[model samples]
Target: MIEIKEITAEETYPLRHEVMYPNHPFEYIKLPKDQEGKHFAVVNNAKNVTVVSLFFENDNAQFRKLATLESEQGKGYASKLLDFIIAYAKTKNAKKLWCNARVNKTNYYKKFGLKETHKTYTEAGIDFIILEMDLI
Candidate 1:
Protein backbone atom coordinates (compact mmCIF):
# COMPACT_ATOMS: atom_id res chain seq x y z
CA MET A 1 0.00 0.00 0.00
CA ILE A 2 1.06 3.60 -0.54
CA GLU A 3 0.01 6.76 1.23
CA ILE A 4 0.21 10.45 0.37
CA LYS A 5 0.43 13.12 3.02
CA GLU A 6 1.81 16.53 3.88
CA ILE A 7 5.47 16.46 4.88
CA THR A 8 8.04 19.05 5.92
CA ALA A 9 10.22 20.94 3.45
CA GLU A 10 13.29 19.27 4.95
CA GLU A 11 11.66 15.88 4.49
CA THR A 12 11.49 16.56 0.76
CA TYR A 13 15.16 17.40 0.34
CA PRO A 14 16.67 13.96 0.12
CA LEU A 15 14.37 12.66 -2.58
CA ARG A 16 14.56 15.94 -4.47
CA HIS A 17 18.34 15.86 -4.42
CA GLU A 18 18.58 12.20 -5.32
CA VAL A 19 16.14 12.32 -8.20
CA MET A 20 16.32 15.89 -9.46
CA TYR A 21 19.78 17.15 -8.64
CA PRO A 22 22.06 14.18 -7.97
CA ASN A 23 25.07 16.02 -9.38
CA HIS A 24 24.41 19.24 -7.47
CA PRO A 25 25.13 20.00 -3.86
CA PHE A 26 22.55 19.13 -1.21
CA GLU A 27 21.78 22.78 -0.66
CA TYR A 28 21.01 23.19 -4.36
CA ILE A 29 17.80 21.24 -3.91
CA LYS A 30 16.66 23.51 -1.09
CA LEU A 31 14.25 26.10 -2.42
CA PRO A 32 14.64 29.55 -0.96
CA LYS A 33 10.88 29.84 -0.31
CA ASP A 34 10.54 26.34 1.06
CA GLN A 35 9.39 27.64 4.40
CA GLU A 36 6.47 29.40 2.73
CA GLY A 37 5.32 26.49 0.62
CA LYS A 38 3.42 23.35 1.47
CA HIS A 39 5.32 20.11 0.96
CA PHE A 40 4.03 16.59 0.37
CA ALA A 41 5.33 13.11 -0.23
CA VAL A 42 4.27 9.64 -1.29
CA VAL A 43 5.37 6.92 1.07
CA ASN A 44 5.37 3.29 -0.02
CA ASN A 45 4.24 0.36 2.05
CA ALA A 46 7.78 0.05 3.31
CA LYS A 47 7.40 3.61 4.67
CA ASN A 48 10.09 5.00 2.42
CA VAL A 49 9.34 8.24 0.65
CA THR A 50 9.29 7.63 -3.09
CA VAL A 51 7.95 10.91 -4.41
CA VAL A 52 8.01 14.52 -3.26
CA SER A 53 6.54 17.86 -4.42
CA LEU A 54 6.25 21.41 -3.14
CA PHE A 55 3.33 23.79 -3.78
CA PHE A 56 2.82 27.51 -3.43
CA GLU A 57 -0.42 29.46 -3.88
CA ASN A 58 -1.01 32.98 -5.04
CA ASP A 59 -3.43 34.07 -7.79
CA ASN A 60 -2.42 30.78 -9.35
CA ALA A 61 -0.97 27.69 -7.72
CA GLN A 62 2.55 26.57 -8.61
CA PHE A 63 4.23 23.27 -7.82
CA ARG A 64 8.00 22.74 -7.82
CA LYS A 65 10.67 20.13 -7.31
CA LEU A 66 8.44 17.23 -8.19
CA ALA A 67 10.59 14.14 -8.07
CA THR A 68 10.28 10.40 -7.78
CA LEU A 69 12.87 7.90 -6.67
CA GLU A 70 14.76 6.36 -9.58
CA SER A 71 13.94 2.88 -8.34
CA GLU A 72 10.27 3.75 -8.15
CA GLN A 73 9.74 5.31 -11.54
CA GLY A 74 7.04 4.13 -14.05
CA LYS A 75 4.79 2.92 -11.19
CA GLY A 76 2.33 5.85 -11.39
CA TYR A 77 3.31 7.38 -8.04
CA ALA A 78 4.07 10.79 -9.52
CA SER A 79 0.83 10.78 -11.49
CA LYS A 80 -1.16 10.06 -8.37
CA LEU A 81 0.65 12.76 -6.43
CA LEU A 82 0.05 15.30 -9.18
CA ASP A 83 -3.65 14.45 -9.25
CA PHE A 84 -3.80 15.11 -5.54
CA ILE A 85 -2.08 18.47 -5.96
CA ILE A 86 -4.48 19.52 -8.71
CA ALA A 87 -7.49 18.60 -6.61
CA TYR A 88 -6.03 20.36 -3.61
CA ALA A 89 -5.40 23.47 -5.68
CA LYS A 90 -8.95 23.47 -6.98
CA THR A 91 -10.23 23.34 -3.44
CA LYS A 92 -8.31 26.55 -2.81
CA ASN A 93 -9.99 28.19 -5.83
CA ALA A 94 -6.81 28.86 -7.73
CA LYS A 95 -7.11 30.27 -11.23
CA LYS A 96 -4.58 27.83 -12.58
CA LEU A 97 -1.95 25.29 -11.67
CA TRP A 98 1.54 25.61 -13.08
CA CYS A 99 5.09 24.33 -12.96
CA ASN A 100 8.54 24.82 -14.41
CA ALA A 101 8.67 21.46 -16.13
CA ARG A 102 11.84 20.04 -17.64
CA VAL A 103 11.54 20.42 -21.42
CA ASN A 104 11.96 16.74 -22.02
CA LYS A 105 9.19 15.93 -19.58
CA THR A 106 6.64 18.28 -21.10
CA ASN A 107 4.91 15.40 -22.83
CA TYR A 108 4.53 13.56 -19.55
CA TYR A 109 2.90 16.60 -17.98
CA LYS A 110 0.68 17.04 -21.01
CA LYS A 111 -0.83 13.70 -20.12
CA PHE A 112 -2.07 15.40 -16.98
CA GLY A 113 -3.70 18.22 -18.99
CA LEU A 114 -0.95 20.76 -18.43
CA LYS A 115 -0.25 22.90 -21.50
CA GLU A 116 3.03 24.52 -22.34
CA THR A 117 3.20 28.27 -22.73
CA HIS A 118 5.67 30.30 -24.76
CA LYS A 119 7.86 30.68 -21.71
CA THR A 120 11.09 28.69 -21.68
CA TYR A 121 14.43 28.98 -19.95
CA THR A 122 17.59 27.13 -19.05
CA GLU A 123 18.56 26.65 -15.44
CA ALA A 124 21.45 24.60 -14.12
CA GLY A 125 22.01 23.50 -17.74
CA ILE A 126 18.54 21.95 -17.96
CA ASP A 127 15.92 23.36 -20.31
CA PHE A 128 12.52 24.07 -18.79
CA ILE A 129 9.19 25.29 -20.07
CA ILE A 130 6.29 26.80 -18.21
CA LEU A 131 3.31 24.49 -18.13
CA GLU A 132 -0.10 25.34 -16.76
CA MET A 133 -3.61 23.95 -16.38
CA ASP A 134 -6.52 26.27 -16.03
CA LEU A 135 -8.56 25.65 -12.91
CA ILE A 136 -11.18 28.34 -13.22
Candidate 2:
Protein backbone atom coordinates (compact mmCIF):
# COMPACT_ATOMS: atom_id res chain seq x y z
CA MET A 1 0.00 0.00 0.00
CA ILE A 2 1.05 3.59 -0.61
CA GLU A 3 0.43 6.53 1.70
CA ILE A 4 1.15 10.22 1.56
CA LYS A 5 2.19 12.23 4.62
CA GLU A 6 4.11 15.19 5.89
CA ILE A 7 7.85 14.64 6.37
CA THR A 8 10.90 16.44 7.71
CA ALA A 9 13.46 18.15 5.55
CA GLU A 10 16.02 15.62 6.77
CA GLU A 11 13.90 12.74 5.55
CA THR A 12 13.78 14.30 2.08
CA TYR A 13 17.55 14.42 1.62
CA PRO A 14 18.04 10.76 0.73
CA LEU A 15 15.59 10.62 -2.19
CA ARG A 16 16.47 14.09 -3.38
CA HIS A 17 20.13 13.13 -3.36
CA GLU A 18 19.56 9.77 -5.01
CA VAL A 19 17.23 10.81 -7.79
CA MET A 20 17.73 14.51 -8.45
CA TYR A 21 21.36 15.25 -7.73
CA PRO A 22 22.97 11.87 -8.06
CA ASN A 23 25.70 13.17 -10.32
CA HIS A 24 26.59 16.00 -7.96
CA PRO A 25 27.86 15.95 -4.43
CA PHE A 26 25.13 14.82 -2.03
CA GLU A 27 25.43 18.11 -0.13
CA TYR A 28 24.36 19.93 -3.27
CA ILE A 29 20.88 18.53 -2.83
CA LYS A 30 20.25 20.58 0.29
CA LEU A 31 18.20 23.66 -0.48
CA PRO A 32 18.93 26.81 1.49
CA LYS A 33 15.33 27.36 2.56
CA ASP A 34 14.76 23.78 3.62
CA GLN A 35 14.05 24.61 7.23
CA GLU A 36 11.37 27.08 6.21
CA GLY A 37 9.67 24.72 3.77
CA LYS A 38 7.16 21.98 4.17
CA HIS A 39 8.31 18.58 3.01
CA PHE A 40 6.20 15.60 1.99
CA ALA A 41 6.86 11.99 1.19
CA VAL A 42 4.94 9.26 -0.56
CA VAL A 43 5.75 5.99 1.15
CA ASN A 44 5.06 2.40 0.25
CA ASN A 45 4.66 -0.82 2.25
CA ALA A 46 8.38 -0.91 2.99
CA LYS A 47 8.08 2.65 4.37
CA ASN A 48 10.48 3.89 1.76
CA VAL A 49 9.80 7.33 0.40
CA THR A 50 8.91 6.58 -3.19
CA VAL A 51 8.52 10.30 -3.98
CA VAL A 52 9.29 13.67 -2.38
CA SER A 53 8.42 17.35 -2.79
CA LEU A 54 8.97 20.59 -0.91
CA PHE A 55 6.55 23.53 -0.71
CA PHE A 56 7.41 27.04 0.34
CA GLU A 57 5.99 30.56 0.60
CA ASN A 58 2.64 31.95 1.72
CA ASP A 59 0.35 33.16 -1.05
CA ASN A 60 2.52 31.52 -3.64
CA ALA A 61 3.85 28.04 -3.10
CA GLN A 62 6.71 26.60 -5.11
CA PHE A 63 7.18 22.90 -5.62
CA ARG A 64 10.83 21.95 -5.38
CA LYS A 65 12.90 18.84 -5.64
CA LEU A 66 10.05 16.62 -6.72
CA ALA A 67 11.62 13.28 -7.43
CA THR A 68 10.66 9.64 -7.57
CA LEU A 69 12.96 6.68 -7.26
CA GLU A 70 14.08 5.15 -10.55
CA SER A 71 12.51 1.82 -9.78
CA GLU A 72 9.22 3.53 -8.88
CA GLN A 73 8.84 5.57 -12.06
CA GLY A 74 5.72 5.03 -14.24
CA LYS A 75 3.87 3.64 -11.23
CA GLY A 76 1.90 6.90 -10.75
CA TYR A 77 3.55 7.81 -7.44
CA ALA A 78 4.48 11.20 -8.79
CA SER A 79 0.97 11.91 -10.01
CA LYS A 80 -0.44 10.95 -6.65
CA LEU A 81 2.04 13.15 -4.78
CA LEU A 82 1.31 16.12 -7.05
CA ASP A 83 -2.42 15.63 -6.45
CA PHE A 84 -1.89 15.72 -2.71
CA ILE A 85 0.26 18.88 -2.82
CA ILE A 86 -2.28 20.73 -4.98
CA ALA A 87 -5.02 20.11 -2.46
CA TYR A 88 -2.75 20.94 0.44
CA ALA A 89 -1.77 24.22 -1.15
CA LYS A 90 -5.39 25.13 -1.72
CA THR A 91 -6.11 24.67 1.96
CA LYS A 92 -3.27 27.09 2.73
CA ASN A 93 -4.90 29.65 0.40
CA ALA A 94 -2.13 29.63 -2.11
CA LYS A 95 -3.01 31.59 -5.23
CA LYS A 96 -0.36 29.84 -7.25
CA LEU A 97 1.74 26.73 -7.19
CA TRP A 98 4.74 26.69 -9.47
CA CYS A 99 8.04 25.05 -10.17
CA ASN A 100 11.11 25.18 -12.34
CA ALA A 101 10.31 21.95 -14.09
CA ARG A 102 12.80 19.94 -16.03
CA VAL A 103 11.97 20.54 -19.71
CA ASN A 104 11.19 16.89 -20.27
CA LYS A 105 8.67 16.90 -17.43
CA THR A 106 6.62 19.86 -18.63
CA ASN A 107 3.95 17.58 -20.04
CA TYR A 108 3.61 15.82 -16.73
CA TYR A 109 3.12 19.14 -14.94
CA LYS A 110 0.59 20.18 -17.58
CA LYS A 111 -1.49 17.14 -16.72
CA PHE A 112 -1.92 18.78 -13.31
CA GLY A 113 -2.96 22.14 -14.84
CA LEU A 114 0.48 23.76 -14.80
CA LYS A 115 1.34 25.94 -17.77
CA GLU A 116 4.82 26.93 -18.79
CA THR A 117 5.93 30.53 -18.82
CA HIS A 118 8.48 32.11 -21.14
CA LYS A 119 11.15 31.87 -18.48
CA THR A 120 13.81 29.20 -18.69
CA TYR A 121 17.05 28.37 -16.93
CA THR A 122 19.80 25.80 -16.89
CA GLU A 123 21.00 23.83 -13.90
CA ALA A 124 23.78 21.30 -13.92
CA GLY A 125 23.57 21.15 -17.71
CA ILE A 126 19.85 20.30 -17.62
CA ASP A 127 17.30 22.76 -19.01
CA PHE A 128 14.30 23.84 -16.98
CA ILE A 129 11.26 25.97 -17.62
CA ILE A 130 8.98 27.67 -15.18
CA LEU A 131 5.48 26.23 -14.94
CA GLU A 132 2.63 27.60 -12.85
CA MET A 133 -0.89 26.64 -11.91
CA ASP A 134 -3.32 29.30 -10.74
CA LEU A 135 -5.03 27.90 -7.70
CA ILE A 136 -7.55 30.62 -7.23
Among all candidates shown, the one with the greatest TM-score: 2
* Candidate 2, residue 117: how far the Cα is off, in Å: 0.2
Query: Clashes per prediction?
Result: 0, 0
Report clash pairs, candidate 2.
Answer: none
Model 2: per-residue lDDT, tens digit, 1-136?
7888888888888898898888899899998888888888888986655555556576899989998889888988888899999999898999999999999989989999999999999989999999999999
* Model 2 poorest ten-residue lDDT run: 47-56
The positional error of residue 92 in candidate 1, measured at the CA in angstroms, is 0.9
Q: Per-prediction TM-score, please? A: 0.94, 0.95
Question: Candidate 1: global Cα-lDDT?
Answer: 0.86
lDDT of 1 by residue, 1-23 (tens): 79998888888888889889999
Model 2 Cα displacement at 26 (Å)?
Answer: 0.8
Off by over 4 Å in 2: none
